[model samples]
Target: MSREKGKEFAEQDLTPMTGAATDVAPLGRQQKPAHELTADEDIDVADWDRVAAMAEFKQLVLAKRKFILPATIFFVVYYFALPALVGYAPGLMSKRVFGVVNVAYLFALSQFFMAWLIAALYVRAANRFDGMAQRIISKLKGGR
Candidate 1:
């Protein structure tokens, strides 16, 4: 509405500040016993058992790596390829359509397209990889 009303609303007190400026309270540093909290208890196990548990996790990691490597390569290639194309093709990207926005600039901006592309690929890959890992884990853990 009016500027003064807006200013007044903006200047309104939000929350109670704790103590003086020098007496700053630690934010979210509260300590509580494990049983007192709702969070799941951290299970303690031997290193060997941890390693054994990670066997399926290792396979999942490998599968993820497979996707990441290819996606990363594609992302890099796509990001740089437009600049290269513009470099080699002079005025190719300089063709202005709607105001100063040029084809080259738009092509460069298409890096977002590559990002989405890579993200989609990674998601699909991870899903498949996770499914495989789940199967393996279920078999190993006796249909868990």
Candidate 2:
């Protein structure tokens, strides 16, 4: 296409499709450059500032961070420690266990269980986070 045609196509008003629109976050929305958009653009977030400012929301963020930060740190340390021990402490890792299996093999196998355990813990924690979010939503909707 010609540059002028491309420009016209880019600037053309594309109306959202009829039907299948939701009360929140309607589909087929046209995206524009941030610089080209007006400051007062209607993005349809209802009282988002109030939501962000709500004590419940703040607590929810904090609760998430509390679980996530420690979990992330633990996982990173546990994961990196395997390679470090193998590379630095070969004698310790080479100690035979169960005839053929060794410490390194056992440790490597344990990682799978560790990952599963962490995932299970995260799922449990996520349920609490979801409840916290639901409470915040309820507050926004003028409920207890």
> Each candidate's TM vs. the true structure?
0.47, 0.70
lDDT of 2 at 76: 94
Candidate 2 yields a Cα-based lDDT of 0.74
Residues 1-144, model 1: lDDT tens digits: 122332332343322233445553344856333333444643221122433466676777787887788778877887878868888886777899779998887877778876887788778877898798667645433422
The lDDT per prediction is 0.61, 0.74
Q: Mark the regions of model 2 whose C-alpha exceeds 4 Å error after superposition.
A: 1-42
Predicted model with the maximum lDDT: 2
List candidate 1 stretches off by more than 4 Å.
1-62, 82-90, 97-101
- Considering summed lDDT, which 10 consecutive residues are worst modelled in model 1? 42-51
Clashing pairs in 1: 93-104
Worst 10 residues of 2 by lDDT: 1-10
Query: What is candidate 2's lDDT per residue for 1-144, written digit by digit as tens?
Result: 122332333343323343343323423666543333467874322345566778989999999999999999999999999999999999999999999899999999999999999999999999999999988766555522
TM-score attained by model 2: 0.70
Error of 1 at 67 (Å): 2.1
